[model samples]
Target: MLAVTILGNNSAVPAFDRHPTSQVVTHDGVNYLVDCGEGTQIQMINYKIRRGKISHIFISHLHGDHYFGLVGLLNSFGLLGHQQELHVYAPSPLQEIIEMQLRVADTRLCYQLHFHTISGEALLVDNEKIEIRCFPTQHRIECYGFTFREKRKPRKLILDSVKQNNVPLHFYDNLKDGEDFITSAGEVIRNEWVTTAAPKGKSYAFCADTRYFEPIIDHIRDTDMIYHETTYLDNLRERAFERFHSTSKQAALIAKKANVKRLLIGHFSSKYDTLEEFEKEARDVFPNTDLALEGVTYRI
Candidate 1:
């Protein structure tokens, strides 16, 4: 199963009821931490998220609200005696900050730490079952949005067809790979006779932090689920643009244009007391929109 759990959803500041940016994406058994804002570790504990399952972290930008908790989380990992390697993907400047913190504390991690710097749009990470790609977003400080796509498997071969045709077992792999089979008797067997194409897999897009930008539509088109930042309602649209952020309406418009099945919006401004307006504004543009709540899990 592929899902995402919101740890923090507030923008810029942490209020008593809301927090900054943070979420946990779980695909299969692996957990990925996206944007570790302050108090994220506590949020993880509060939500009963298994810290040991997190194998990777993705930071969208250099904003304090996006990655202030990263050092603390890394320190906690060491204190907890985690031995698995952890991979972090972020801008190049983050490496220095993390290294300085580790130096000042004279602490050494028990596991290997791998850092990958994202310098431009479209960074790809391929695993066995999942593929994650990062694209540039129109934020003030070099922000990025990520898309997670499940790899589509090749079609299954029909063993009954192979047997009925007396086809060689070794050629079964070829059929699954969509290749026509040539029998020993010089007869060509069509791939459709033995196999059918697999169904398309699901995809999730995370528009971490951004203003209303048209180029993002192409990157997130046809996603199964999309998480976009809606830091304010339509009334606060001017403030959102001044701060290089997005309003609820803008996020929904992106989802609508991208043809995403569902939209999850959060990163609300601290000034708002209730999220009812945010939901109303977004749903007006895209009916399939939902307000992202902390500790709530969303299936992609």
Candidate 2:
């Protein structure tokens, strides 16, 4: 399963119980932390997320609101006696920042911390289970958006037909790989006759803080779902551009242009406590938009 759990949604400062920008993307039992904002670990604990399952983290930028909780979370991992290597993908300067804090306190982690600097559009992870890639976003400083794509799943077996035909259990793996099964009596059973095609792989895109930009459409086009920041209302479009932030309508336009299956909008400015208007403004343009509520899990 490919899903994203929102931990914090508010931008800059915490308000209305919203902390900062943090999310957990889970696929096939592995969790990827997208942005480590302040109080991230606490949010994860409150949400019943297994911190031990997180082996990779992707920070969109070095802004404090975006990544202030990273060092604390890493330290907590060490305290928890987690021995697996931790991989963090972010800007190159983040390595120095993390190292300085570790140095000052004379801290030593039980596991290795590998920092992979994202430069422009780069593929971060590619394995049998999942694929992750990053693309540059139009923020004030260098920032990036990440896309997670699940690998194709195995073909499903026809239980009744397989049982009736006496197909051996050991051949199940072969059948899932689309190989024809041969019975002991020399009768060949076609793979499709007893197995269904694999399910379509799901994909999710996380677009971090950015101004109204068009190039982003290419990076997140046609995704199963996308999380885009809508930091302000349409009336403040001028202010949003000055601050390198996006308005609700602007984010919706991107979702509409990209033809995504669904859109999630969050990162609200602390100026407004009530988020009903944000949803109304986005849905007006893109009907499939949803508010990114804290602690909610959005399945990709």
What lDDT is obtained when candidate 1 is compared to the true structure?
0.91
Candidate 1, residues 5-94, lDDT tens digits: the string is 999999998985898899999988999999999999999999999999999999999999999999999999999998899999998899
Name model 1 segments beyond 4 Å from true.
none
In candidate 1 the C-alpha lDDT for residue 241 amounts to 94
Q: Model 2: runs farther than 4 Å from truth? A: 159-174, 179-191
- Candidate 1 matches the true fold with a TM-score of 0.95
Model 1 / residue 257 / CA error / Å? 1.1
List model 2 lDDT by residue over 1-300, tens digit each: 999999999999998899899999999899999999999999999999999999999999988999999999999999999888899999999999999999999999999999999989999999988899999899999999999988888999999888888889999999998999898889999999899999889999999999989998998989999999999999999999999999999999999999999999999999988999999999999999999999999987
Q: Give all TM-scores, in the order shown.
A: 0.95, 0.91
What overall lDDT goes with each candidate model? 0.91, 0.94
Query: Which model scores highest in TM-score?
Result: 1
In candidate 2, what residue range of length 10 has the lowest lDDT sum?
159-168
* Backbone clash total, candidate 1: 0
